[model samples]
Target: MTYWNQEIETMDPVRLRGLQSERLVKLVHYVYEKSPFYKKLFDEKGIKPEDIKSIGDIQKLPFTYKKDLRDTYPTGMFCVKNTDLVRIHASSGTTGKPIVVGYTQNDITNWAESLARGFTSVGLGKDDILQISYGYGLFTGGLGAHYGSERIGATTIPISSGNTERQLSLMEDLNVTAVLCTPSYFSYLIEVAEKEGRSLKNNKSLRVGIFGAEPWSESLRHRIEERSGIKAYDVFGTSELSGPLFTECPEQNGMHVWADMFIVEILNPETLEPVKDGETGELVVTTLLKEALPLIRYRVGDLASIENTVCACGRTHPRLMRLTGRSDDMTIVRGINVFPGQVESVLMKIPEVSPHFLMMIERNGELDDMTVQVELNDLASDKVEDYNRLISRISHDLRTVLTLSVDVELVNPGTIPRSEGKAKRVIDKRKF
Candidate 1:
C-alpha cells in the first residue's frame, strides 16, 4: 500500500494550514450533527459550524477533557451506532476513571496503516522477525503493534508482556531479528538475561527495537541499543489519538508526524494560543479524516513542539521534538510548576543515582511536601553526608530552575517496584 496522499504530507506550511482549515470545518459540522455530547455543548455555547472557518477558530470550541468522556459514560459520547464500532479499548482506571475509545472497521484499518507507516519508517519489513512484548486485550498497545507488524509483512512472534524466560526462549529459537516493547520492560529483560547467563549483545540476528508507551531520554535509548545489539527507535501516540501518530526515522533526531491523518498543533496550555515553531507547548490534535469517534481539537496532555524543517530521510512531514513531559504530570507546588521528568533528568545525570527513582508529593501538616526518593546504585558506598550534599545540590538546581525547594532521600536500588507497563513515577499522597 502506497501513501494515502503524498502531497498532503509534503505540503508546505502555508498550504498545509489551508488544508487543515477546510478539513476542520467539515469535521466540526460532522461532529455537531452526529455526536449528542458535542451537539448539546455547541447549542448551549451558541456556537455554529460556520463559526469555525479556519483552524485558528478551534479556540472557540470547548476543550474536551477525559472527564467529559467519563461524564458521558459508556455510549453517550459515541458519534456512530454500536454496530459501526468494530473495537473498543480502555486505559487503566488510575485517576478515578478509565478513558474509553471506539473504532469503526475503517478506523481499525486506518490505525493499522498508521502503525505500519511507523514500522516502515524504521526499515521494518518482511525480512524482519518481530517479537512483540506489549500486553494484549483491552489495552491498545499490543494489538496496535501486532497488527502494524502484520501489515508491514513482518514475521511476528506474539510474546505478550512479562514472562521473561519464555520471551528469551522464543527470541533464541526464532532468532528474532527485531523486538517491539515498552522501554522499561526492554531494560528489565536485558537485566534478567544477564543474571541468567544469557548473552544479548552477541545475538547477530537482532537488528532493531521499537520502544514506547512512556517518556525516555536519549541516554536510555543508547543504553537499550548497546545492551540489545540493535538500533532503538521511539514511537508516540495515545489511545484517544490513535496509536502511531508519530515515529522516529533512522536519523533519530525527532519523530515525524503523519500529517495526512493528524493536524498536530502545539498550544500554550494556559493561554490556549498556538506557540511559534520550535517552542514547546502542550500537544493539541485534530483528526483531519476519521469516521467514528473523531475528536476535534482534543487536548492530548502531552507537552511537545513541532518543526517544519525537512528531514534527512526526505520525508517533508513535520517533525516533533521528543516529549518533554505531560501537562497532567506537572505538579504545582507553592505556585511553581514542577515536572517529574525534569527531576528524573537531573537524577540520571548524576552518576551515583540509579535509573529507578520516584517523586512523592504530599501534604506534611498543612504545607505541600515535595521529595525525590532516589535509588542509589551502590548501597555500601552511600553515606548520610554524601546524601545530604547531593540533595543540597539537587535542591539548588530545582530552586534555580523551578523556584521550588525539595527534599531528596537516598534509598537502596531495587527498593522501588519496577513497572512492566507505564511507570508510576509520581505519587500524590495528598488527600482531598
Candidate 2:
C-alpha cells in the first residue's frame, strides 16, 4: 500500500545509479542497431554505443531535440518496426510537422507502470473514483492518466475536458475522490461551480487533484487547494515522453522522475553542461527503457531544475522541480523576458485577484508594450477607486517582477476564456 513498486521506487541511490548506467549502455546499443536515424546520427558524431559506458558519459551521446522528431516526421525516428508498434500519438504540429511517437506493447505497459507508480504515491486506489478532464485522442494526457488510474484499480471517468456542468455533476453523482486535468481548467471549474451555486469547496467526496499539461506556479496550486479543498498535485510529462509520467508524492515538494525508466539532465543554457541539482536550466531527458521511439538526451525545451535529494515520501528517485517556464512560451516585451508562471506567482499572492490572467504583447512604433489582464475575485470591491488602486498595485508588482512596466486591466471573474485543455495565457499580436 505504501508504494506501487517499493523496491524500485525506494531503490538505494547507489543501486539506482548502477541500474541507470546499465540501462543507458543497453539503450545506446539498442538505438544504434534498431534506428536508422540514430545510427546515422551516431556515426556522424563518431560515437559508438560502447562509448556510453556509464550515465556520466551521457555527454558524449548526441543530444536529441524536438526538432529532430519534426524533421523525422511520422515514423522516421521510431526504433521499432511497424509490426512491433501497437499505438501512436503526436504533437499538435502548431509550429511545423507534428512530432509523432510510437508505442510498442512493452512501451505501453511501461508507460502505464510509470503512471501507476505516480498514482499510488498520491494515495489513489481501488475505492477512489477519478475524473480525467484532459483531452483524449492524439493528445496523451487523458489516455495516459486513464490507464494509470485503472492500473491502480480506481474507477475512472473518461470524461475528457470540457462540459464543466457535466464534469461537476458527475463528480458529485459518482462521489469521485480525485480529478485529473490542467490546473487552469480545474480552477475555471471551481469558478463555474461557484457561478452555478455549487462551489467545489462544498464537494465532500473529491480530495485529490493531479494537474499538468501546462506550466503552473506554486501560488496557483495553493489557491486551488484553498478554493476547492483538494490536495492539488503536479504531474509532469510531454507527448514525446509518454505523457503524464511523473507526479508529486504526498510530500508535495516535487514530482519524482523514475530513474529506472529514464534519465533526466538539466543543462546550463549557455554551456550546455549539466548544472547543479537545484540550478535552473533547460531540461534534457533520455529514454532508457523506451523501445518504439527511444530518445537519447532529448532536449525537452522546458526551463526547470532537478533535486537529487530523496523525497520525504521515501522515494529514492530524483525529483523534477516545478517548471518555471518553457523556452518557447516565454514572451519578450520591451526587451524583457516574461513567463506567465512568474505573473501567476505575483497575482495569486493578491487576495483581490483570481489566478486567471492573460498577457498581451503589442508593438507601438519602436516600443513593445505588455499588458496583463487580471480577473477580480468576488472579494474585490465594486468601487471605481478600489478598482483603480488594485490595478495600480498589480501593475507595480508586475513591473517589479518582470522588470518591465505593464498595463493592467481588471476583468470580471471568468471573463477570460477558459480552456478545457492547456490554458492560453499569452496573446502576442506584435508582428516580428
Candidate 3:
C-alpha cells in the first residue's frame, strides 16, 4: 500500500513502545526544565523528572486539566518564548479564558507530517486537488489541514469556510478531488446543492471527505457518503494536540493514533487508572515530540477506547474507537465548541435575564440547531417591544461568546422548573 513515512507508521510494536519510552524519558526532563508550570506541578506533587523513566510510569505523573490551561492563560504554559513561536492558536474559551497554544518551526513541521500521513493513507497525493472548508484564524483546523495538503504536494484551495455558493462553484470549476470540513457543514452543502438542482452524487471529481471537529455516527457517515458520493473519513485532534492529527485508513475503521508522537491512555474518569483495552474511558494524552507546548497526561475529556490489535490496514499504531461522548459538559454546534457556563456568563451580564436557563440542541435536517430557553428576572419589563429588544440583545451576546447563532426564548420568571439538587442546564436531542 502507498504510505507516508512508512518507517515510523509501520514500525514493530515492541520497537514503537521502546521509542515511546525513550521519548517519555526525555520529555519529562525537557518539560520540567523548560516550563515553570510543569516544574511547579511536579514539585507540588513531590515527583521528579527521574520518576518518569518509562511509559509505564506515566500514571505516577499528575493529570493536567482543562481548567489548568485557563489558569495559565495566554503563554504561561508554553515552554518557548514568544519570539521562538512560529504560530499561535487558541480555544473558543467556552468555559473561561481561551486555552492558548504555540508552535515552534519544528513543531509545525511535525504537525504537518502527522496530517500528511493521514491524507496519504486514504490515497490522496500530489495529483489531488483538495478543498479545505474549515474556518481559519485563531482556530487550528484551516491552517493545519492546509499545511498538510501542501506537504503531500497536493494542490490546495484554502476556501476557509462560509460563502456556500462560491465553495460549490470552485468544487465544480477546479475539479476538487477531496474536501476537508465538519460533517454538519458538508451536510448543509448537500442541501444547498439539491436546492440549486445540482447533484453531488453525480459529481465526477469529488472522491474523498476528511470530516471531524465534532462527534458523528456511522448513520451520519452513510448519509454523507450517499449524498456526496465520497468516502467519508473521520479525522480527530484538538488544537492542544497539534490539530487534526489522526485519520481513518482505506479500511474505514477506527482512526489510527500516531504512536511515535503521542502516548494515549484510556483511563477511568473517576479512578484515573487505565481501563482494559477495548473498554471506553476518558482519553488522556502525553505529547512525546511537541516542542513549544509539550503536555504530559493531559486529560482530553473525550470518552473513547483504544484497540491494541493491529489495524487491518497494516499500521501498528493503536486505533481510537468511535468517541462515545465528552467527560465534561462541553457541546459542539456547527463545529464550534460551546459550554453552558459561557451562556450563563452572558446571561449574568444582562439585568433582564435570570440564571435559570435551559439549552436545547436538536438536529434540523442535517444541521444542528441550538435553542436557549431562559427565564426573565422579576423586575423585567412585560412589553412586547421590550421583550423583542431583550431577545435580540441576548442572542447577539450569546453569538459573540459561542461563535454560533442560537435561538433565544425569554420565558416568565417561574416558567422553568426549579431543581433542589444539581441543576440541569442542557437537553441534547441529537442522536449522535
Candidate 4:
C-alpha cells in the first residue's frame, strides 16, 4: 500500500524518457489519423506524424489553448465517438462557452489510478473514512475524489458540499479521518466549529486534508495545520488534465507528476521556450495515455516551477512547486501587475485578518481603482480607532510588497462570501 505502481513510479530517468518518446511517436500518428482537428492543424503547419521522432521534437507541434477547446465546443476535439465515452465533465463557463471533456472506460481507470496513488501517498486506506466536501455533478472535484476514495477501499461519505451543521455532525459522528475540499471551505469550517464551542484540534479522527481547486500559499497551509491539527497536502490538476492528477508525498515537498502518463514542460509565457529547472513559468503538458481527448502541448495557464531531482520519498517523477498564480488571472492595476496570490500572502501574515478576502477593481474617471475587502478575525477589536489602525497597517504592508497603493477595507468576520467550490477572489468592473 505504500506505493501504487511502484515500477513505473520509480522508473529510471532514461527509460522514462524512452517510454515518453515512444508514446509520443505513436500518439502523433494516432491523432493525425483519428482527429480531424489535429489533422487540419498538422496539414496547415506542413508537418506529418513522421516528423515527431522523439520527445525533443515535440516543440515542432502547435500549442493548444483553452480557446481551442471552446472553439471545438461539444465533441469536435474528442477522438472517440459518444458511444465510447463513459462520462463527461465541463468547466463552469463563467467567462464564455464551457469546455467539455470526455472520458472512456480506460480514461476513467487511469484517472482513478492517478488519484489512488495520491490518496495512498497521503496515508489513506480502507480503514479511513473520507468526507468529500467538493461539489458534484458537472464539476470534476467531487466525483473524482469519490472514485479515488473508493479505489483505495476507504469508507467514503460522498457528501457534496454546503450544510455546515450536517458537515460538522457527520465529522464527529462518522469519525471522518480524511476530507477533500477547497482550503477556503475548510477555513470556514474551522470558524463555524469555534462558534459552536468545538475545536478541530481536539478531534481525534481527522488526520489528513487534501486541498486544491484554487491557488493557496504556504502561510495558509500552516494556518490550516495549526487550526485543524492535520497534515495538509495540496492536490493539483485541471478538468482538461483529468481533474486531480498530482499529490504531494508524505514529505510534503511538492506534488509529484506521473511521468509515465504525462510530459510536463515549464515554458516562458511570451517566448514559449523552456525555462531553466526550478524557475517559475507557464505549465504546458502533453498527455500520453488519454484515449478520448488527447491534447498535445496544452497550455494549462498555471504559473509554477518543476524540480526533476529525486525526492526524499524515492519517487523519480518530477515535482511541481506550489503554484504562484495563473498567467490569465494576473491583473494590471494602475499600471502595476497584481496577483491574487500576492494579496493572499500579505493577508495571511496579518493575524488580525482572516484568510477570506475579495479584491474589487473599478474604473473611476479614466483611472483604475483597486480596493481590498478583508474580514477581521474574531479576536480583533471592533473599536473605531482599532479598525482605522488595522486598515492602515494592512494598506502599508500591501503597498510595501506589491509596490503599489491599494485601499484596504476592514469588515466584521463572515463579511466576505464563503465558497464551497473555488473561491472567487477577483471582481473587475472596468468595461474593457
| Best model number under lDDT | 2
lDDT of 4 at 310: 89
Give per-residue CA lDDT, model 2, range 1-432, as digits (tens): 479999999999999999999999999999999989999999999998888889889999898998888788878999888899998888755445678888999988999999989989888899999999999899899999998989899999999999989998999999999999999999989988988899899999999999998999999999999999999999999989998899999989999999999999999999998899899999999998999989999999899999999888899999998999889998888778889999999999999998788998889999998889999989999999999999999989988998889999999976888788888899999997
Q: Write the per-residue lDDT of candidate 3 for residues 136-213, one digit (tens) a residue.
A: 878788999999999999999999888988989999999999999876578667756766888788789999999887
Writing each residue's lDDT as its tens digit, candidate 4 over 253-368 gives 89999988999999998898999999999999999999999999999988999999988887889999999887878999989998998999899988888989999999999899
Clashing pairs in 3: none
Clashes by residue pair, model 4: none
User: Order the candidates by TM-score, highest first — what do you get?
Assistant: 2, 4, 1, 3
Q: Which structure is stronger by TM-score: 2 or 4?
A: 2
* Model 3: residues with Cα > 4 Å off, grouped in runs: 94-96, 330-432
Query: Against the correct fold, how does model 2 do in TM-score?
Result: 0.98
lDDT by residue for model 1 (271-294), tens: 888899899988888787777778
In candidate 2, which residue ranges exceed 4 Å CA deviation? 94-96
Cα RMSD, each candidate = 3.1, 1.1, 12.0, 1.3
TM-scores for every candidate against the unseen true structure: 0.88, 0.98, 0.78, 0.97
Cα-based lDDT for every prediction: 0.78, 0.91, 0.86, 0.91
Predicted structure with the largest TM-score when compared to the true one: 2
